[model samples]
Target: MYTETPAVVMRQIKTVNGRRMIVLFSRKYGKISAGTSISESGKNKSALALRPYTYGRYELSKVKDNFYINGAEVLRSYYRIGEDVDKYLQASYVLEFTDKLLPEGEPAEALFDLLTEFLSMMEERKQAYGTLVLGYLCQAIAWSGSAPDLGVCSGCKDAEVKYFSVKDGGLLCEDCAGKAVQDRRLIFPVTVDIIDVFNYLLESPLKSLHALALREDLEKKVRNILRSYIAYHLGIEELKSESLIV
Candidate 1:
C-alpha cells in the first residue's frame, strides 16, 4: 500500500551506509520504519521531517516486507525548542518518555495530538515548562489507560487523599498509605483541581495550557510518578532518545 499521511519522527538512525528513522506511535499505522537517502542531506535536508519531534506529512509505501518513506514535507520543525536549554531538555523528556509509554500501531490519535501540542507549547511561550510537560504526561498516561486511579484513596475509602503511591497508582489518604505500602509507596497529595487541569490539557485546546500555574514541587512529583509507572509498564530501563535529554 502507498500512502501520503501525517507522521511524527520518534527516532533517527545513522549507519555507515544507509540512513533510516523510526516513526513509532503514529496516528495512521501505529508504528513505521522509513528509509532515507544521503542525497537528501545538506544545510536544509528535506528529510528533517525524519528528525525526532518533527511533525509533518510523509509519503510512505510498502516495499516487500518493510515500510519505507519515499518522501516527506516538513510541516512544523519545532526548531525553537533547540534554542532554549530548559525547553530543549523537557522536549527531549517528552519524546523519550512518550516513545516508551505508547504501544506500537495502537491507533493513538490522542497521543499524537498530545505530543504535537507539547512541542507547540514549548515553541510558543511557557513559563512553567516543567508543569506543562508533567500535566501533559498525566493526561497522556490516563488516556493510554495507565493513569493512576486518583479518584479515591488507594487504600481507604477516604474521599480526600493526602499522598500518592507510584507503585500502586495514585493518591492515598493516611489510612490507605499505611495499609497499601507493603511493597512500595510514594506519598503525596494531588489536588482534585490538578487532575481537572490535566484533563483540560489532554482534551481541550492546546493553547489553554499557557494560562495554568505550575507548582514546582508538584510538577516534579507528577513526573516522578508518571515516569516510574511508564518504566514499570514498558519494562525498559531507557528509551532510545533518553540521551537527547540526559
Candidate 2:
C-alpha cells in the first residue's frame, strides 16, 4: 500500500558526510522526518526540494519499513526568509515551535494551513514581524486547545479590568487574584490591551497587519505573558529561539 500526503518543509539539515534529514509538517500526518541522500554535489534535485521553508510536492516511499522522500518538486522557495538575519531567525523559530508543539501523523489541516500562511506572511509582508508572529501564536495556540482563557477573570470571574495570571491561564479580577500565589506576575492594563490587539489582528484581514502598529512597551508585556503561558502549559523553562531576539 502507498499514501500521498501534502506537507510543508519545516527545515533541513545537511552533513558533510552525506547525511541529510528533512523536517516536514504534513497536513495529513503531522510533523515527520524523512531521510534523503543524493550525490555530494549541491546540484542534487532532491536536496533542492527539501530546503527549509520550501513548500513543495513530495513522494514518500517505503524503504526497509521506513518512509523516505524518494522525489519532490519545489513549489515555493520562500527565498526572502534567508536574505536577512532577523527574518531567518524568526522563520526558524516558527518552524521549530511548530515541530515541537504539533505531534506527528495526527491529521491537522488547520495547522498545515496556518504554517503555510506563516511562511508566506514572513516572506511577503513588510510590516512588524513581531506583531505578525504574536498574532499567529495566539490563534494557533487557541486552535490547539491550549488557548489562554481571556473571556473572564480566572480568579474573580468579574469580566472587567484585571490582572492576568500566566500560571493560571489569563486575566484575574481583583477578587480572584487577591490571594497570594507564587510566581504570579502582574499584567498591566496596557499589556492586556495589547494582547487584545494581537487577538484582533489575527482575525483582521491579512492586508492590514502589514501596517500594524505594535507599541514596544505593550508588545513586550503582552509577549512576556504569552511566554509565561506557553511555559506553564509546556512545562519548559525557556525557549531556545528566545535568545535569537535582536
Candidate 3:
C-alpha cells in the first residue's frame, strides 16, 4: 500500500548497498522507519526532504510489514538551525528526545504539532536556547502523561510545598520532604521561582516561550531537576545529543 503524510526526518542510518533507513515522525503514522535510495546530495525534492531539520510530505510504500520511501517534498526546512553550533545541538537534542518518547506506529499528533512549532521557533531564536529547550521538555513530559505534580504537594496534597521529589513524581511539602530524605529518595529544594517556571512552561503554548528567560543559574537548576525527573519516570537516562548541547 502507498500513502503520503507530513513528517519530520528524525534520524538516518546508512544501510547496505548505499540505501539508507530514515526514521520519520509522521503526522499520520507517528514514528516509522522507511528504507530509501534517495541521497541527500541528489538534486530532487525527495532528496532535499531526506535531510535533517526538514518537515516534508513523504510518499511511502508499505510491503507486508516494512515501509519504503518512494518520494517526498519538503514542506518547510529549518536549515538555518545548523548555522550555529549551539542552535544545532539544541535542535538535535529535542529531535532525539522526541524519537525516544515516541513508540513505533503510534500516532501522536499533538507531539507532532509541538515539534513543528518547536523547530519553527528555534530556527529564529537568537539567545537563551536553554530556556526554549526547558519549555519544550516540560510540555513534552506533560503530553506524555507523566508531568510532575506542580499544583500542590504530590504527597499529602498540601498547598504549601517546598521541595521536588523525583521518586514521588512532584512537589513535596516540608514534612513530605523530610520523610523522602529519610527514605533516601532524591529530592531537590525548590523555590517559588522554580515552581513558577515549571508551571508557566507546562501551561503556556510553545510560542510564548520567547517572553520568558531564566538566569543561567536558574535554567541549569531546572534543567537538572527535569533531567532526573525524566530519567526516573520515563526511563530515559541520557540522550547522546545531550552531551553535545553544552
Candidate 4:
C-alpha cells in the first residue's frame, strides 16, 4: 500500500551507491526511515524533496514492514536557514530533538506543525538564533507530554514558584524547594519572568512568540533552565549542535 503525508527531512540525507535514504518526521507517521533510487540518468524527482529541512508531501510505498520513498513534492524549502552558520546550528538542534525524542510510528501532528513554523521563522533570519531555539525547546517539551508547569507551585499550590523540579516535572514552592534538594531531585531556581516566558511558550502558538523580546543574559538563562529540564527527563547528557552555536 502507498501513503502520503506532510513531512520534514530530519537529518542529512544519506546515499550509498545509487540508493538514497532519509529520516523523516511526518504528521501522519512521526519518525520513519525511507529510501529511493537515484536514477543513473539523473531524472529523480524526489531528490530535492529529500534534502534536509525540506517540508513537503511525501509518498511512500510500504512492502510488508518497510517503507520507501516513492516520490514527493516540496511544499516549502527552508533553504535560507543553512545560509548562516548560527541559524544552521540552532535549527539543527531542533531537528536533533525531534529525531531523538519522538518515537517511530507515533503520530504527532502538533509537534510537526511547530517544527515547520520554527523552520519557516528561522529561514527569515529575523529573530536571534538563541531565543528562537529556546522557544522551540519549550514547545517541544510540552508537546512531548513532559511540560513543566510554570503556574502556581505544583507541590503546595500556594506561595510563589521559586524552583523547578525536573524529577517532579513542575515548579516548586519555596517551602518545597528545600525538601526537593534534600530528596536529591534536580532543582533549578527560577525567576518570575523566566517562568512567565516558559509559560507563554508552552501555551502560545509559534507566531505569538515573535512579540516577546529577549536579551542575551535572559536568553542564556532560559537555555540553561530548559536544557537541564530536558536532560534530566530525556536522559540526554548534551546536545551536539549546542556546542556549534558559539
Give the residue spans of candidate 4 off by over 4 A: 12-16, 39-44, 181-185
Give lDDT tens digits, candidate 2, residues 91-131: 77777777778876577788788788878888986656777
For each candidate in the order shown, give its overall lDDT on alpha carbons.
0.68, 0.71, 0.91, 0.80
TM-score of every prediction relative to native: 0.82, 0.87, 0.96, 0.89
State which candidate, 2 or 4, has the greater TM-score. Answer: 4
| Per-candidate clash tally | 3, 3, 0, 0
The segments of candidate 3 whose C-alpha lies over 4 angstroms from its true place after superposition are 181-185
What is the C-alpha lDDT profile of model 3 across 1-246, one tens digit per residue? 999999999999998988999999999999999999887689889999999779999999999989999999999999889998999999999998998989999999999999999999999899998999999999999999998878889879999999988888888899988876434546989999999999999999999997667899999989989888888888886799998765
lDDT of 4 by residue, 1-246 (tens): 898998998875648777766789988988888877745244355667877889988999889878798888889988988888888888998898778888888888888888998898888856677777778888888777888866677888976778877778888888888766444537778888878777777888778766566888878877777777788887665768877774
For model 2, what is the C-alpha lDDT against the true structure? 0.71
Among all candidates shown, the one with the greatest TM-score? 3
Clashes of 4: 0
Tens digit of lDDT per residue, candidate 1, span 140-185? 6677777566567767668877666767766678777767734553
Per-residue error at 94 for model 1, in Å? 0.7
